[model samples]
Target: MKARTALLVLIVALLGYLAFFNFSTLAQDVPMSLGFTEVHGPLGLVMLALYALMAAIFLAYVIAMQATWLLEVRAHNKALQAQRELAEKAEISRFTELRGALDDKQTQWEKRVMERLDALENHLKARAEESDNVHAAYLGQLEEQLRNQPGKESPPALGQQ
Candidate 1:
């Protein structure tokens, strides 16, 4: 695998650097450093090769991790979207049911209102008829009284009354 190869290369370079640099001797500025005796040249090439391999390995790992995390997020988001859609549908259905019930109630209320109005209209018509009959009877009584009054100045002529 590329990852394994890169890891191996990195290890080799790191070891080479340790042998050549001899950090302990360098830090103390010791004469004839251990690194010079141990590494025996070629230090730069060894270190470079190892560092390149390590970089490759780390890059691959990071890319794989990023891809995996991306996929998981996408799947989770999809699931949430599905759930949201279902909830929306349920809410819509509930609203529709409520709307239907309200419509039915409104229709019933309108019917009752119309029926009451009709009853009131009929009652008013009857009352009007009764009033007309009472008025006619009163007129007849007045006419008879006038006729019986004989020659009392002819009971004041028309508009004179």
Candidate 2:
């Protein structure tokens, strides 16, 4: 138990022990004033009974308040747990969406790269073919020029040699 509550219990126990041991003194009659009128009663016992009644009422109130607070705490905890779960789910969803987006971007990039490579390959092949044609044309012109020389014997044509 908490220190304060333990102390309160100890005090109540001592008071109860005192009251039990001095029952006769407590029961002795005495004069008392009711706010409205004067009366005679066992003054000590009456005071003790009133104190007990007040203690009982206060204790009941304390117990009820504590019970209400406990219930409120439980409800708040449940609400917090639910919110935490929702946040986790949302985070998971965002991650999944990001993953999908990345996958799509990678796929598009790969496709574009492949297309670019294919275009480049085609362009290179066309350039190589054009170069070969130009080389053949130059060879033909050289052979003709050599054959047409006026005073020099044309050496046997290039490939024939």
Candidate 3:
């Protein structure tokens, strides 16, 4: 279906056709020398088998490398996730600390305001008491003067004409 797959299939077909056409030559026995003995086998078929074995080995190597790469990528992603979690935790801790400081500052400000209000109330109370004392002394002096006047029998009532 895909272009690369089609190309591979075409190449295999061509090779197969060539092999089939040369079947008799491929089947012809040839002498092969081992270290201690001589053997006979089809040379073309042996060569084809060796090529297939090498191709299989190469494919295995590629699969092993791909597996290794996948493992490394997974490890890297895990490390990155861990770092992100640590950063988030640190940020939350910083936020909590800042919030606590702000709350403490607010409490102190409220306490100061309350103290100032109490001081003002006490000052006002003291001034009112002093005014009351001065008024009472002035009234006492007026009463004594009225009693000492020789012609006055008694002081007139406040509402009398």
Q: Which prediction has more favorable lDDT, 1 or 3?
A: 3
Candidate 1 vs candidate 2, lDDT winner: 2
User: Alpha carbon lDDT of residue 121, candidate 1?
Assistant: 92
Q: How many angstroms is residue 81 displaced in model 1 relative to the true structure, after the best TM-score fit?
A: 1.7
- Over the stretch 58-112, how does candidate 3's per-residue lDDT look in tens digits? 7799899999999999999999999999999999999999999999999999999
**How far off is model 2, as Cα RMSD?**
4.2
Highest lDDT scorer: 2
Q: Is candidate 1 or candidate 2 better by TM-score?
A: 2
- For model 2, the superposed segments whose C-alpha errors exceed 4 Å read 37-40, 123-161
Using TM-score, give the best candidate's number. Answer: 2
Total clashes for model 1:
0
Off by over 4 Å in 3: 1-25, 32-38, 124-161
Model 3 residue 63 distance off true place after TM-score fit, in angstroms: 1.1
| TM-score, every prediction | 0.58, 0.68, 0.62
Task: Pull out the clashing pairs in model 3.
Answer: none
Residues 4-122, model 1: lDDT tens digits: 88997798688767756875543443233365464344444545577769878988998999999999999999999999999999999999999999999999999999999999999
lDDT ranking, best first: 2, 3, 1
lDDT against the true structure, each candidate: 0.78, 0.95, 0.88
